[model samples]
Target chain A: MSYVVGVDAGGTSTRALAVAPDGVVLGTGRSGGANPNSNPPEKAAGHVETAIREALGALEPASANACVIGMAGTAKLTDPQVAALFSAVWERLGLTGVRIVTDPEVAFASATPAPDGTVLVAGTGSIAARIRGRRMVSTAGGYGWLLGDEGSAFWLGREAVRRALDELSGTGRLGELTRSVLAAADVDAADRSLAWRRLITVVNGEAPVRLARFAPLVSAAEDAAPILDRAARLLAELAFAARDPGESTPLVLVGSVLAGPVGARVREKLDGLDVRSSTDGVLGAVRLAGIEAFGEDFATVPGDLPRVP
Target chain B: MSYVVGVDAGGTSTRALAVAPDGVVLGTGRSGGANPNSNPPEKAAGHVETAIREALGALEPASANACVIGMAGTAKLTDPQVAALFSAVWERLGLTGVRIVTDPEVAFASATPAPDGTVLVAGTGSIAARIRGRRMVSTAGGYGWLLGDEGSAFWLGREAVRRALDELSGTGRLGELTRSVLAAADVDAADRSLAWRRLITVVNGEAPVRLARFAPLVSAAEDAAPILDRAARLLAELAFAARDPGESTPLVLVGSVLAGPVGARVREKLDGLDVRSSTDGVLGAVRLAGIEAFGEDFATVPGDLPRVP
Candidate 1:
């Protein structure tokens, strides 16, 4: 019985699935982070190998005809060292024809069977990619927090701090959002002048991307509608930037920010387009591997490609 | 023989000027950086003392009845340790009645004799200060590079890199600004895909504020007009935010960004207002010290205050 193995390699964790050619789930496995950018290349590759090994389970690894890895930081593989590390993992696992693709490509594939579409991811950072032939061909606004990352969780958290500072700068009453922000930063609001200064210091004291921790507070506050609206608008603009003019294709919205209020607003802004939400990228990886093993018609196999929940 | 001393203590250098009651420049001194936030408190205080002693020039430090220091990062002095160091500098110099104020206050005083006005500073960071009674009472957008600092040199440089990334993300023609950004980042434009990725990596590899180094490139490129215009708009908004509605007091523009093309655009946006440029903050320090020593009317003393060049 021929089978295919698929893995979704993320920053914090990695997951793998092995499936028979007939779309039967053979086994599953999970491991630690495998993103080469944040994790050491050897460790990342080791995690990928571990997950795939577990997924193979009692099934013969040599029986898998194809393997696909949907990785968050696939760009890191451009480095020869990292590429070699990942290659070594495949060799040790006795896996051949291993294909590695960006998480966005898998995300788009997970949402729809369309070969061409747009995938917008707004997790800690944000980026929009144009997918053609189930692959990310180009991207927009993935410049990280320093450059862009507009509409990202990082952007949302930074905006929350800016709002708190703005409220503290004036004599007006502090809004609920400001109060929540001050509380989150563990800064006392008794002295407005000192509060703002302290808040700035606290935010700058940590890693810049850690600012994403404040993002959840934004959505929970009643006075944070403007921030949410702006985030949605920026995210929609980013999605459109990655698409061709008037090109109507499935737009897959992935990431935590898109799963809540901001995502709803983004959907409102993109009223005309066919929008889909993809939560699990591993399923997408499985679908891609299945297609590679069973040809294009495998995409239409109902039991083979699971629906994105 | 009762002269007043004024010092402008900045991040890169410190300058001191001794002025007579009638506004005649007595002696001048210059030294290294004295910003407590960037330099050690002891070193910063020592630099301030060195500059002031040189300005006293063969005269008794006790002869100066009043001394005013216009310092960048005056907030750093709020820390007890830093304040103690500065106090020690005053005592060692045998200087009494020493007063320290923010750079914006002195910049406002340098531009005009008005007791109330606005001061906009846009160097590596950006801020707008509201001056009342010759002191900064309130401010806008001085939240540092992490939170705000909109329209700052850092903001301009960051926008330049973003523009380059945008151009590289698409297959369209690269603009002059994009080419210049690529060159400045030392990224080879041979492969558009590799160039944009390389540019982002190069930027992330450095200190966040170092992005300000690219500000000059934005001004030098003709295609960078949109970025300049947006920066001007943001700065104008910041200046207006610091002023009360219909308040017609003088608006003093300070810092290197305000001395260049971005400054020109900001001035144009701020048209119909009382606009002034203040290049020498030390002169303002002298003017303030003269006022504190002689009387409020001393502001009009022609010989006691030199024109801002």
Candidate 2:
């Protein structure tokens, strides 16, 4: 009855799963966001422990033979104090040696059965990584929303607004994109100049990273085809940048942007690549734990996360 | 004596100058930042009024025949509430009519006394504008720090940090820039991976716009030649984008970036072009006021702004 614990700590939520050595689903749990970059260390760590505790239901704590926690913004934990906070959580869970990694690694594992591959993620932010033996050995672009993330959701959303701004400033022809952008911004203005200025005000009024919200509106606009084209090309370029040309391996697409119309466009651009979509990151965490506990062959455990939401 | 009041309301400080039709300096005053986008609207307007009222010392407020207030982030005032806030300040100053223009317009006029020319500004942010009749007729780029501002201080700084991150991530080589970036971030990790993670944490800790602080360090780096080269090329491209070929208007360079080595490089890139540096934007505002109140002949008012700082 030795069980392995797996956790996915994201910006919005935290989820955990426990699976026996033979892949019997033991338990599951979820809690509020546990990303220390977005949440306080004390609170984030507290939630991680809460989720793990709940997932260890009924079984003796020592029965958890191995554990893995995958978190977005894992770089934030590089600080000694933040690292201490999470390590304390591990001690409380009675786990002696727990593995922690960035969410991209787990996402890559969930999508395909490969020890080495390329992973392209495009959500509120975007990044691409080259995974070797289930670990990210190198990355192409993960400079966050400010420096890079060129083809991420934020880039596409900013492009949509840029096109509208250009049209409003008399550089380009106004069309459905302009209307959709204005409508999305809830700016009612008869004059194009006012609308243009209003859009800037609205966008700047919030956190700059939240610009990703407008990304969906781009898919609804006709002229957004150009943006989609650039996104797919940039995303594919990033994925290609991570892998050696002659080496053929699985290419994993993760997050909402890479799972939607943007993903389809990226798929077309990456025609010959072996591609797959990540179904659930928690499942990936479970599989990773399986590997760490029972070696590579056992890493492909029977589905133990069928009901994980 | 009849006079025109010119105000340069910036993010750090607001300066006001009163110039007589005969081009003699009447009075001058200064106050804190009044950029409504960065400051509270009420406080910004109060600063504007304070700067103007103090500049009107011992002079009849009504004697100001024309008044012009140049401010950055003018797009923020497009909001009715923000506009009304400034209008109240005008009423408090007892000004009959106040012309409000973007900072680039005033910067253009300050440099060469051209009624129509090209203005390039690259300080904390960057933008290129085509000035027509002392007004911004068209702009090539000014999309702010998040979306655009290609060669601004923020862009340069982000490039420096990006270069360091790339080096740490294996795509680039460690050099003077890497050491400078790491030292500036106060990350003392010996291992490259730990240093890379720490650098990302340091950057994501603060407001992204503040990355401009690191821009100056890039200039201090030995291998910043490529960044400088790319900056000059991109800036020239933007200025070129704002106008048609063969039309030789005065190309105005403003802001700290354009006044430094970066500017010298940019000048080298643009051979055979009429170029000038804007000493102070308040001079431009004064010239603009002189043009509005005094017809074209008086618009040639010799030394419209002599002592403006």
Residue-wise C-alpha lDDT for candidate 1, range B1-309, written one tens digit per residue = 999998999898999988888778888888999999898889999999999988888888889978999998888887898999988988998999999998999888877888999999999999999999998999999999988889999999999999898898888899998898888889999899989889999999999999999999999998999999999999999999999999999999998898999899999999999999985788888889989999887787633455422
Clashing pairs in 2: none
The Cα error of candidate 2 at residue B267, in Å, is 4.1
Q: What is the C-alpha lDDT profile of model 2 across B1-309, one tens digit per residue?
A: 898988999998999998888888888998999999899988898899999998899998887899988998787886899999888888877898899999998888777766888998899888888888878878877878766788889999899988888788774558898789889899874788778767877898988888888888877888898998898898988888877788799999998888877899899977899988887888878888888887665555634456555
Q: Model 2 off-target regions past 4 Å?
A: A12-15, A24-33, A39-61, A75-97, A268-272, A303-309, B1-3, B13-64, B73-98, B138-140, B220-222, B244-248, B265-273, B303-309
lDDT tens per residue, model 1, A1-309: 799888999999999998877777888888999999899989999999999999898887778888999997888888898999988998988889999989998888777877899999999999999999998888888999999899999999999999999999999999998999899899999999999889999999999998999999999999999999999999999999999899999999999999889999999999999999985788888889989998887675423445322
**Best-fitting candidate, scored by lDDT:** 1
Docking class of 2: acceptable
Candidate 2 at residue A295, lDDT? 77
lDDT on C-alpha atoms for all candidate structures? 0.90, 0.84
If scored against the real structure, what TM-score would every candidate get? 0.97, 0.85
RMSD of 2: 3.8
lDDT measured at residue B115 in model 1 versus the true structure, 0 to 100: 90
